[model samples]
Structure formats: C-alpha cells, structure tokens
Target: MNKPLLELKNISIKYDDKLVVKDISITIQEGEILGIVGESGSGKSTLIKSIIGLLGEGGHIVDGKIIYEGKDITNLNKKELMVIRGQSIGMIFQDCQSSFCPIRTIGNQLYDSMKAHMKVTKKEALERGEEILRELNIKDPKKFLNSYPFELSGGMNQRAGIMMAMASNPKIILADEPTSALDVTVQAKVINELMNLRKKFGTTIIIVSHNMGVISLMSDNALVMKDGECVEYNLTKKIFNSPSRQYTKELINAMPKLKKEII
Candidate 1:
C-alpha cells in the first residue's frame, strides 16, 4: 500500500460550456479504501465517470492527467481503455439493477462476462459465479442465478452487482453510491462485503457516496466536495473531528445522531 495505484492530477471535467469538476486531484494507494462524499450534483459521479471514460456524450476531461499503474490513461484509444476496464479496474454503479439486461437471467450475463474476460467454459463460469454469490451471502445462489433481474429484490440485485464486479478479481474497484438504495441493515452488509474483498484480494477501492456515515465505515480517507471542487481531503478522523472547512464541519453536523462515530 505504499505506492499510489491511481492518481488524478488537477483533473477538470466539463459538459458543453458548464464546468462540473474543477482542478480535482487525489491519490489512491494500493489496498486503500477512499471515500468521495458530496451533495447531489457536486460532480462525484462525474469524477468517476471521467476516470473510466464513460462520460457519455458532451462530457470531456478538459485538463490534467489520470495515472494508473504508472501509466497515463488521461487519453487512451478505445482498445487501450477496454484493456484496462473490467480486467484491471471494476466499477459498481448506484443503480446496480439498471446495469443488468432486463431480458437476461443472472447466470446468462455472468457466464458471458466470465467468458469474455477469462479462459472458462460456460459451465465453469456458471459454477464459479454461483460460488462467488454464495460467498457474498446471497441466498440460494443456484435459484437466484436462474432468476431474471426483476425477479429479485433491489438489495439482492445490488449485491449481485457487487459480486459481478469482484468476480473478475480486478485490482481496483470503484463503487458509485453502491448502498444508497438499500435500507440501513442491507447497507451495512454491502459495506462489510466490500471490506471483506479488500482483506481477501487486497483490492484498492474508491467509494463515492453522499452519506458521511457510510464513508466513515467504508473508507480510511475522505474527500469532501462541493460545487465541483474539493472542500477538504484528509484522513477520515480529521475530516470528521477537525474539518478545516466550514462546509465539511456542517456535513459532519448534519450526519444522523446514531452515526456520531463518524465525527
């Protein structure tokens, strides 16, 4: 964990004439968990999107570089990017279910994904996927794997998404508001599973969320953002206990009473 796995140096993103993320720089070290927190529209999601080159249309990284594994990926061709995403870096979105095909069963997608990235037959992929889901505490992996996306509850689908993200054993995982849709109990379970991934695979993780409480439990370092710029970036304890910015202090104050441990 001594070396930086990914570095965002003075990165700026814009959609048409409107600037979203401005001069944002952060370093994620090996086997470290980083939390990016901010209110809605604070450029949290946009920042991550810029990382994986998934900014869709009209969004561009106008300045700065994104260094990954000592290589600058700030601007790469389509083939170069395909070689990095999924194989080396994995991403789990806020609405996990939305990423799945409504017409496909869980196993179908899992098998195809595995076959694409690994040297495995469909049968082998299905079995491996079932085992991964079971390890994640998904109930009756066989049955759930056979079910369509809508057949399972939101929490189950979210967990399945997490399972899929880790199935490839990527070195880095980027979670964008992974637990926002789940209840408190389910949220804890998801966070626990993510921590387990770090311990088991030494996966470097970057979690983005609006909840400071979630950040407290999941990240060692916190990055507080507002209006597309970093308000504070430091160790979690410092951000919580002695925030340098008034906005960060207000964020700690706004956290629920039950989550006093965050501050």
Candidate 2:
C-alpha cells in the first residue's frame, strides 16, 4: 500500500471561543480525489481552510495535527507556512473574487504568483501562464491576460483562479465549492477540468461541496460531515449506495435523478 499524502489527526477548529469543527480525522492518498460534502455551515469550508492555514481572523485549530508529505505543519511559523501554502499546498477559495486582486491585470496576478515561488523571468512567466490558460481552453490568452478580473465572466474567473493555484505545481490542492457559482453547463466544464488537472499534474485533490452528485462523479472516496462532525467516510460508491448516516441518505435523495427515456 502507498503512504497517505496528507493526514489530519483528530483535528478540531474554532472561531474565537466558539468551536465549530469537532474532533475529526482524514487521510488522502497520493493522486486521489477526496470529496467532502455537507450542507452550508456544516464546517466543510472551514475544514479545508484549516489545512492551508487560512482559518481567517479569530479562528484557529484547537486540536490535533496536520501532517503533509511526512511533516507536522500544525504549528509552523508564518514564514515556513507560506513556503508550503501555495508551493506545496494550493487552495481554491469558495469565492473566486476573493482569490484575485480586482485592480490588477489577470496576467500580472498569475505572473506575480509564479515569481513568488519560482525563479522565472517575466517572459518565462508569461509563456507558462499562457500555456496553462490555453491548456484549460481559455480563449485569447493575450487579451484575457491583459484584462482585469472584473472583465471576465464568473466561469472564466473561476478557471483563472485554478490557473493561479496550479501555477506552483503543488502536490495537493484544497478546493472549496469550486462549482457553486456557475451555470449547469459551466459547472460541468469546471468539474471536468478539475479532474483533468489531477491526470495532468498527478495532483492530490480534496474538494468541498454540498453536491453529492459532484462528489460521486469526482472523487474516489467521500467524507460526509454534518454540524462539524463526521457523518460517514468511505468509498464513493458505498457512500452513494449504502450511506451509514441519515444525513448522507437525505443528501443523495435530494439530487435530481436522471430518468431513462422510453423507446
């Protein structure tokens, strides 16, 4: 068996004096996609944030450890953590706008992020950036790169954010609600691209979503959370076919089932 790529051991998180995420643990294997699903405010977002040290103001991990690539990162200083954040571990925010600078050109944003971690010149950065955007099928990289984030559509911004996260070629990506803001067709494109990213980079992904269908489609294993506690964690098929918790069952039942057409 292969060693786990990332591990959370009995972790708990709190915002100020209020404990939100209860004691929980998770392990992600190399090149595997792990889906975390639950209703809003179920601690899905906060859990992923904690992994990358982005729990925000007044929030902190109250218990356990976050081990990545065989190192305990729970208490690393900001400087050390920064090295790991985007280079070793990338994060996709639930709100794509929050991930980018509104006033800057999207090209500058990607270039700056890449240079922050890589020793690449401006020309090299631009080339690499164009390659990634084109790989994701973003049309007119030259024009789009020169435009500010506000000039692009929601789906484009979302995919651009993904480009920034992938800029560093990180080993693991923690994505929170990556598809929540797009239309059905755009959502499918984003979903397919995320899966393709793993195949293209061998990146280990942990995606947080409220959509059970998305989870079943994207992940090999699924973890269900409710009110900050673990509901069930198992293979995606098992979780879909025979979930161990009522919450998981309700989530599955809520999805719009596809009906077969009569001949």
Candidate 3:
C-alpha cells in the first residue's frame, strides 16, 4: 500500500495561549477526499489552517507533528513554508471574492501566483490559467481571465478561486467552506467541479465545512469534530449510517431529509 500523503499526529493548536484544538489526528491518502465537519468554534477551520501554517496571529501549534510525504514540517520557517504552500499544497478560502484584489485583473493575479512558485512567464501562466478554467467548464475562459474579481458574480469568483488554487497542480487542496457562501445551485456546481478536479488530477483534498450534507456528498472519509476534539472518524457511509457519537448523529439529524437522501 502507498504511504499516507499527509498525517496529523495528535495535533493541538492554540491562540494567545488558549487551546482551541486538542489532540486532533487524521491521515489522508492521495486522490482521497477527507472532510472535517463541525459547528462554529468547533476548531475545524483552525485545524485545517494549521496544516498549511495559516493560523494567523497568536495561533500556534503547541504539540504534535504535521508530516507531509514522510517529512516533519511542524517547525519550518516562513520561507520554507512558503516554498511548500502553493507548489505542494494549495488553499481555497470561503470568501474567494474577498481573497482577490479589486484592482488586479484575474489573469494578472493568477500570473503572479504562478510566477511565485514556477519559472513560467506571464504569457505561459495565462495560458495555463485559461486551460484550467476551460477544464472547469467556465464559459469564455479568456474573458473571465481578463475580468476583475468584482466584475464577476459570487459563483464565478468562487470558481476563479478554485482555478487559482489548482493552477499549481499541487498534490493537495485545502478548501475551507468553499461553497458555503453560494446558493444551492451554485454550491452544487462548485462541489461537482471540485470532485471533477480530483478525478482529473488525482489531487488529494481536505475540505472543511459545517454542512453535514456537503461532507457526506464529497468525502470518502469523515472526521467529526466538536469543541476542538474529534468525536468520530470513519468512512463517510459508516459515519452517516452508524455514527458512534451523539454529536455526529445530531449533525446528521439536522440535515434536511432531501439532503440526507441525496447523500
């Protein structure tokens, strides 16, 4: 069997000396989708952020190791982490529109990002960006690339965000509530696009969401978190059908029947 692509061994995170995530652990294989699901302040977001070293101000990993491809990266410096971020691990934020700069054309921003981790020129980056946009089934990839973030609708911007994260062809994509801000139709589109990405590139994905329905639909395995601790971790079908914890069952019960049935 192939070794796990990423591993979180007893990870504990803190902000300003206050522990928010405690003893959370997960193992992800290549081309697999792992969903981290929990309610607000459940530390789901914080736990995901720690993997890519994005836990902002006063937040730090107090214990445990983050092993990627069998290497310990728990204490890498900024420069070291920077080299790994986009080139090896990509991230898609919840508010993708806000993540983009209003002044920069989408193409310009994409070029800059690609340039940072690659030796590609502006023209090359734009070409690659357009190719990915086309693959995502975006209409008129060239027009969308030239358009600014504000010029696009929320759903379009979210797609652009996915495009940007995927530009590097990283092994893993860490998406934090990537579809929560969109309507149901748009959410389905984004979710389907993400699934397609994995199928096409064999990219491993770690998606964090509060929506149990989303988790059930996208993930191969589920890690259910509550108050910074993992209450349950198992195959998605097993968790949905036979959750071992009350919290996991409650989350499933809260989902609409339609959504549950769809899962």
Candidate RMSDs in order:
1.8, 2.6, 1.2
TM-score of 1: 0.94
Q: Which stretch of 10 consecutive residues in model 1 shows the poorest summed lDDT?
A: 254-263
Writing each residue's lDDT as its tens digit, candidate 2 over 41-117 gives: 88998899888788889989999999988889998888787889758998887778767999999889888888777
- On TM-score, the candidate that comes out on top is 3
Order of the predicted models by lDDT, top scorer first: 3, 1, 2
Residue-pair clashes, model 3: 0
Supply the global lDDT for candidate 1.
0.87
Error of 3 at 130 (Å): 1.1
Instruction: Candidate 3: list runs displaced more than 4 Å.
Output: 257-263
Number of backbone collisions per candidate, in order? 0, 0, 0
lDDT of 2 at 254: 81
- Which lDDT values do the candidates have, in the order given? 0.87, 0.85, 0.91
